[model samples]
Target chain A: MPVLYASLLTLFLILIPGIGIGLFNMKALFGIVVLYGAFLIFISGVIYRVIIWAKSPVPFSIPTVCGQAKSLPWIRQNKIESPHTSWGVIKRMLLEVLFFRSLLRNEKGRLKTGGRLLFYRNLLLWFGGVLFHWSLFIIIIRHLRLFLEPVPSFVEFIYGLDGLFELFTPPLLITDLLILLGIIYLFFRRLFDPQTRYISISTDYFPLMLIFAIVITGLLIRHVQKVDIMGIKAFLIGLFSFNPSLPKESNTIFYIHLFLVATLLSYLPFSKLIHMAGVFFSPTRNLKNSSRMERHINPWDYPVLVHTYEEWEDEFRAAMKDVGLPVEKEN
Target chain B: MVYDKGKVITGLVVFLIILLSPLWYNALSGKVEPSLKLSMPKEEKSCIEERMFMRSNHMDLLIKWRDDAVRKGIRTYKGLDGKVYRISLTGTCLSCHIDKAGFCDRCHGYSGVKTPKCWDCHNIPKEEGSKV
Candidate 1:
């Protein structure tokens, strides 16, 4: 089914550019048009999505509380989980963005043989998520060396730290291995977990397969394909500066890597991959749990015309008096 | 069940427009084609490496040369054609590619690539007058 279709679609995406640039020599198309197009789409689409999310009104203070809220002076409050102020919310967001604190607390439940419930910390998901994100960040930072002309000191420092082991000729980067392992763990988790498998759709599997293909192509370029690094830097620098160029004898693997990256960038806005940007605008994560202290009036709420009890009484007074009923005002 | 179809459709339309903005811009502006230029040396018949290899890998070769000359004190580079070249920017490369502006900046300027480090230690030839 869906998984098969997703896998095939992902394979086709990888192959189209892989073959186009590698075999048909459509390097110029992939290098210039695809790269620039993807970048523009990525930037504009993200901004559009973020703006749309921002425009949507949050009518209530719905911050998810995982720990004790601010109550009595003597009672301790969990500022990170159940924030009461803007500063507390900032801290909570920092923890959520950096460490995925909420995900870290995820638990799995099972029914025991004696009909008792059992709960266990699901550390594997958290570990894989953290590893994937951090490694991806490090890899992106390391790639700055190619885009930048002078090769910034921070990028060099990260690159040095990543290749400190010096295991092989080109020196194996730890993040490379970590990202691959992380993606593998995540993919397998989705497949093995019955609950996850039941809920998973083609979209879920497509990104995983796409990312796997991207990472594999990248690895192949670094180790197996033997691409000209200087050429890549030149091409990238040129690209960023608006004067684009492709090396005459560019490696096919490089084109594959670039195409996959382009595909990911373009697909980001439409797909669930936009959770990266959506997380910040999420009402549950961004809002402070301060409904107890401060009243939240919905900005969209309108003043309504209503018949008050006093008005009702006045209107009915004449009719009541006519019928000889007791009225409050005996004018 | 009570869904704002109009709002949802508007959002979808906006999303689609944003996603297709690049393609639209490209079609309208006619800036899709990319032009690349590399400077050709006047006197030198062959570089230390092949023309195609040099075009793509000149920066790497230069970096390796810089490290070897500055750190290891090895100034000679054995070419693929069994020729030993004395690896110095001013003494070797600039000798035949006399005008930095005409030879180097032509391609670098077209590519919008800035290499400030090359001139940090070595003085730019006064004849060219620092176009970069």
Candidate 2:
């Protein structure tokens, strides 16, 4: 049911701009309105989510400690795993973001035919994550060519390097190949893995299906169903300039690819994908493990009214005398 | 209610800087013109294929021509207009395109595409092609 819904929804999204441009010729609506609206939503939505996360006060220095913390001089501290200082936290965050250290280090449990429990590190998921993220980073950076006028030297250098193989007529870029492989691996992993599939909901497949269509449409425009490169650039430039114009030589496939991209951006902030921003705000990942060395007081802690022993004794002196009991004060 | 106010500001500043880098870079340069125009052939009234087809699918056509000529030992191409043209890049494409810099390099440079390996095999022509 999840698979059917995701695939059907993706097909419907493609047909939207496809039919809009192909039949109705509403280029301006998709080209200008949808694209810019998505951008506005994406930027503001991400910022809002980040700010909302920042508003919540962290009440503890409870960082997840996997190794020896900073203590006695003779005892060595595993700084990266149980960070005590801000600098150590930074290093740990870098390792987590760049390398997916947690995923790589995490162990998976399996049950054998003989009812034996086995524990092992699953590298395929880690490898797939790394592949997908790095490829995405490269692809996004390369796309600066369309957004920036007189493309920067670094962009040009990377572009040349990525297309070094220069195999096909348009050149089969390595990142493109890697990204496709990564996405396919991710989709099948989710489908085949028992634990993952059991926990998976419909929304998980939505992004995968949408991105798959987007990538396929992008490949089609570049290699198979070609579009006018010149006109497309002009249209993009106009969008950035806040003066939108529909190109006369536009292709339906290009519009479909673009619509999918816009949809992804718009959906990012509201979905689980907001973790891109939330990662930085994570208490476990970002907090310092200095609970013993420093007091971890709650920010909302406030003072309360109190009664002194002397005041209580003075008030009860008369009552004590009547009852013939000893008192600290004389009447 | 917020914790780490300084860190939050710094994070947001950094995020905005990277996200808006393209806009700022382009705005500072004050150059908005899309400079990917190709110089058309002067004497040739029509290409082997239509102009629109040539604009987008030229690379595929060129590759097919190269394979057909070199690997299959086929040297003739049947144009959509039913004209037979020799499958030679230097003798045919450059005869009209003339200036490689103006006709080819401009688009490639603007798009940040690597200079194709076509020149490794084909002979270099004089700049008079642009003058033509």
- Top of the candidates by lDDT: 2
* Candidate 2 residue runs with Cα over 4 Å from true position: A112-116, A308-331, B127-132
Q: Using TM-score, give the best candidate's number.
A: 2
Cα-based lDDT at residue A316, candidate 1: 91
Tell me how far the alpha carbon of residue B104 in candidate 2 is from the true structure, in angstroms, after superposition.
0.4
The residue-by-residue lDDT of candidate 1 on A115-172, one tens digit each, is 9999999888989999999999899877766655455567777887898786643567
For model 2 chain A, where is the 10-residue window of minimal lDDT? A241-250
Q: Pick the candidate with the highest DockQ.
A: 2
- Identify the CAPRI category of the predicted complex in candidate 2: medium
Give model 2's TM-score versus the native structure: 0.92
For model 1, which pairs clash? Answer: none
Span of ten consecutive residues with least summed lDDT in model 1 chain A: A144-153
Candidate 2 lDDT tens digits, A85-111: 889999999999889999977678989
- The clash count of every prediction, one per candidate, is 0, 0
Q: What does DockQ give for each predicted structure?
A: 0.06, 0.61
